[model samples]
Target chain A: MEFLGSNWIVVVFMVVATFIMGFAMAGISSVVGPSRPNKAKSAPYESGIPDIKPVRPQFTARFYVIGMLFVIFDLEAAFMYPWAVNFDVLGMGGFVHMMIFVSLLLLSYVYAWKKGALEWV
Target chain B: MGDQPIWITFIVTFVIMIVLLTSMAYTTWYERKVLARFQDRIGPTRTGPAGLLQPLADAVKLMGKEDLIPEAADRKVFYFAPMITFITAILAAAVIPWGGTIELFGQSVNLYPTDLNVGALFILATGSIGVYGIILGGWSSGNRYSLLGAIRSAAQVISYELILGFSLVGIFIITGTMSLKEIMFRQHETISFGPFEIANWFVLSQPLAFVLFVIAAVAETNRAPFDLPEAESELVAGFMTEYSAMRFALYFLGEYISMIIMSLFASTLFLGGTSGPGADTYWPLGIMWLVLKAIAFLFFYIWLRATLPRFRFDQLMGLAWKVLLPLAILNIALTAFFRLIGNGQVF
Candidate 1:
């Protein structure tokens, strides 16, 4: 228990407990709630019209583009955390390196902005 | 309950969960009552005094409602997804420190459930995991509205979540660590200015980061104004269109729990968690202070919901990528620059 790493045991216990709680909350409903299912009730809700087509609909390409940019930028954030944590030890040199790293990412972000990659309806 | 062998962890976890569940339930009531006041109407008043027991009433009512699973839905995924959301949201709260370590019955125990070295990042990771519930649940529901909700959530999270990650870099630079307890402790310290002594709260030093964090945190939780994922008018409950009974409650719990957790996280980072008059001497006072600060943040969340309209998906994305992200990055650079200069490491 003295070891700092052992604290995660509490975390694991918490997660498992919370997950069970989630299940129990829903399970209670399943056991106690009414279950008279009809075709109208089972149908997927889309205003009032009944659907013949499959549920798979095409999404905009912009979501994909945004997802890609997220990967790039959040990874930048991940990389920067360590540098930020060690800011004092690394000094001016680390500062300059991080600036260069961030500026390059910003430049790409600006490129995306100018290219209208960020535009959405 | 005094000393136990290996049950300390269980006890701590139990207490934290109780606190979170109570707060989460009340947050719904708080939002409705506050929002109603904003609109000059009375909210739920018949359940209990001032509708105080409305959450309990709502929970009991939801239990009697039919558990409607769409015939075309993927049974396994829909069933599993809500658990993912609820679990991850509660798990994130495990890292939030209620106060510093203290002694009771000759045993020293930490005030929080657990203090991880990467406590802040742990919250972020859990939040990212919570999104999967919406994405998978929506896609597996076999509804077009739910699918659109899923797509919007994916896009919204990617943009807002990125800024959310970057917004904390300034705090990391200022505190020189990612452990939320240490950051809170750092802010709790007093500094001398002329003849005045004031807390070194990060909000004062990193005002820009604080502002950016508040915005991103709101968007990250998918709350009102940022709640395009569940825009009732446009998407009819969004990803939850096909959900019924307590399955819907699971998502509701997830959202409310995450809201309280984010408020706790924000109070810890910016408002000096567990810090108040005599808090250092009496540890329980610290918890009181933290709760007060978290409640203030919760009020802010409700206020925003009442005051503002939902953002267009395009505008939401543009704000994240174009405005908040750059500002967050700039905050990081500025903090690093000044931090080094303060240390006499940079001229």
Candidate 2:
């Protein structure tokens, strides 16, 4: 098993502290604040008219396309992080290997850009 | 790296928490005052001397205001969503190095909370998940405008986040480490250039990456010019539309805190964080430099807000995919070639 370090302990404390911080902010506000409720007040807010709309509206394909592209490119970038961090030890051979890999990803990116899949209004 | 006592660690962590929270509160005041001066008006003059207590007063007022939940809202998600943004933003600050270790009461106490080998990656990962709060909050509000706002934000965040990650790739390749503390220290190594001695800050070598990073960081924080999600004229505060009182206050806090964290993150990565004249002899000067650099970046953020117009949605997406991505790739390729040259692998 990988040994747990002191750094992880500080991190845990930080997580716990911030969690409490959020709760304290919200909890104090809820307790100290008033609770006067009415129909008009509870309605979903908008600028002027505040009209109610259809529930869970269907979104266009543009969002999903962007999401998928993000997943693909983000993964490619994630793969590069370790390689970049080890660049010095890895030397010229690693440099050539990474360049080839990144160029392929860029080519694919270019293909996506040309396919009209990236267009949004 | 040291086996410090658990109690001491706890105390240090607690202090860091207080600092992050306090800096976040003051950042709001700083932004307002800076923007006010830019517009030729004094901001928050009545609350206290120079309105220094305005953030405190605002916090009390917000806490006292009645909390509201829309009748059609998902009560659980709406209640919890703001916390997601708040926690993630606050968590990133834990890894930021305030300065080198300081000797405190016969004990060597590190100025930073922690230094993960994957510190840079940790910040980016938190940033990636940070958008879920917006997406979920908007969806749960049960309104079309909220839904649209969420969708736009999801798209915007993902696109810009890619640029943010890629921009750092140049620094990673140059430094050969993802640890923020290590990156900062690496930048402190001076290289002589004829008449002038210069510290090897990444901003000097990888200038393109720095520019890309600033643009991407501003968009990630949803500051003006990139504040499409919360564009009041369009989506009416976007995912924040259906929120009020304490929940609203948390989101507001989260944004400002994220701004501060991003500023610190940028300084740590590119500006030779905590490395300044006299910083070697007097350690507090390092912290002072860190604060000054972060504040400068924060000022730059407010300046952009006061200067630029918001980008159209399509234009924002296009710039990320078409412009920034290719430039980032080019930067990586150039850095790699230079690395090879430095390694004596190329003539």
Candidate 3:
């Protein structure tokens, strides 16, 4: 709690610093930079040919699948960290508990693999 | 730690910010020079002596160039995306332990900006947030190639992030702490084998985790071989294809700074940050040691960029999901098994 209280200041400072640096750079460039926006210049670059369709085309479902799997595994990894940090204190109980958790996750991984969900195609 | 004067903390934070900005500028020059050596050609010799001032010249040129916005672009998202990238990249530095505490003007000051109990998790969280810059930038640009590039980047970062997080579980297990400062302090003690003493760096004990961490880190930063995000041949400039002038520079700055941050994290986690020989006798030596380790990692990143060919997109994703992720999980299991047996809690 004490750490959080002191560190929030640091966090706020960092956030403000990032914004200041970003805006300062943007402002300087905008002030100094040339602004000659013509019709050809403003169009999106597409190998010199004009764009025919809208940019937001339908993407593959694989990306969505990867995202779902990532969330599940990322959560697993997140849970494992706190447990790992206290492995000594947790002793045998923690070891067995983590193994059970991991084994269940591994089963899901295997199921994903078997179902071809891991395949990029 | 909370008792320190707020002004003093601000000054320290400002100094670190300056250092990060300067280093971020020089890293581009460093990469070019090193890449030139690897390719048997001289790089950027015209700007200043040995091109030491090339970054300054480049900054001036970028600032003077036209700031272009595409007609079809989402103006707000396009403009702020780079800012998002730059912000997240810089935030991760707040928790890094640059060195042990040192006495300045008869007052002890920690070398780190702020020490958090969950410092490691803070880094991971910030890293995850960085992807938004790429995704939103690419999507808002109204360019098909940019969208494809962003999708590739999003997938790459997400997959490898798991490996990166899992790889560090070994360190957290061994040290019994997530605070980088505590981990560094833990490494300061020497371990002996037969009559020889060795620094108790996590790299020596957890070699697999170190390897996995480095691999995933490279992918995480979207650097070469893993640089499918900005494959110049295919996607023009990736998410920054529509960006020009300072907007593009923000993304560029974000990339290099993230590389440096990852190098710092690697050194802190595996190489016993700031804990080299002679560091105990002179505290400043600890900072020097930390800087040296980080530079070595940065050089390694540049070397790999110069040497390795980029992987195909499918191969890139496959390596992360099939190889690195599983290996990371195995590493965690192995760590748990050894720790349990060593403690006489299993067997």
Measured by TM-score, the strongest candidate is 3
Question: Model 1 segments beyond 4 Å from truth?
Answer: A1-4, B1-6
Give the per-residue lDDT digits (tens) of candidate 2, residues A17-60: 87888898899988999999898888777555666565756988
lDDT of each: 0.88, 0.87, 0.91
Q: What overall lDDT, based on C-alpha atoms, would model 3 receive against the true structure? A: 0.91
Candidate 1 on B1-347: residue-level lDDT in tens? 12333476578778889989988899999999988999999999998899999999999999988989999999999899999899999999888998876787887666778778788999999999998999999999999989999889878977888888888998888888888889999988999978999988888898998899899899989998899999999899899999999999999999999999999999999999988898999998899999999999999999999999899888898898888887888888888888888999875
lDDT tens digits by residue: candidate 1, A33-87: 9999999989989798989888766887888898888889889988998998888
Please give the lDDT score at residue A8 for candidate 1.
76
Comparing 2 and 3 on TM-score, the stronger one: 3
Task: Supply the TM-score for candidate 2.
Answer: 0.97
lDDT at position B238, candidate 3: 87
Chain A TM-score values for every predicted structure, listed in order: 0.92, 0.88, 0.95
Which order, best to worst by lDDT? 3, 1, 2
Evaluated on chain B only, candidate 2 has a TM-score of 0.98
Highest lDDT model number: 3
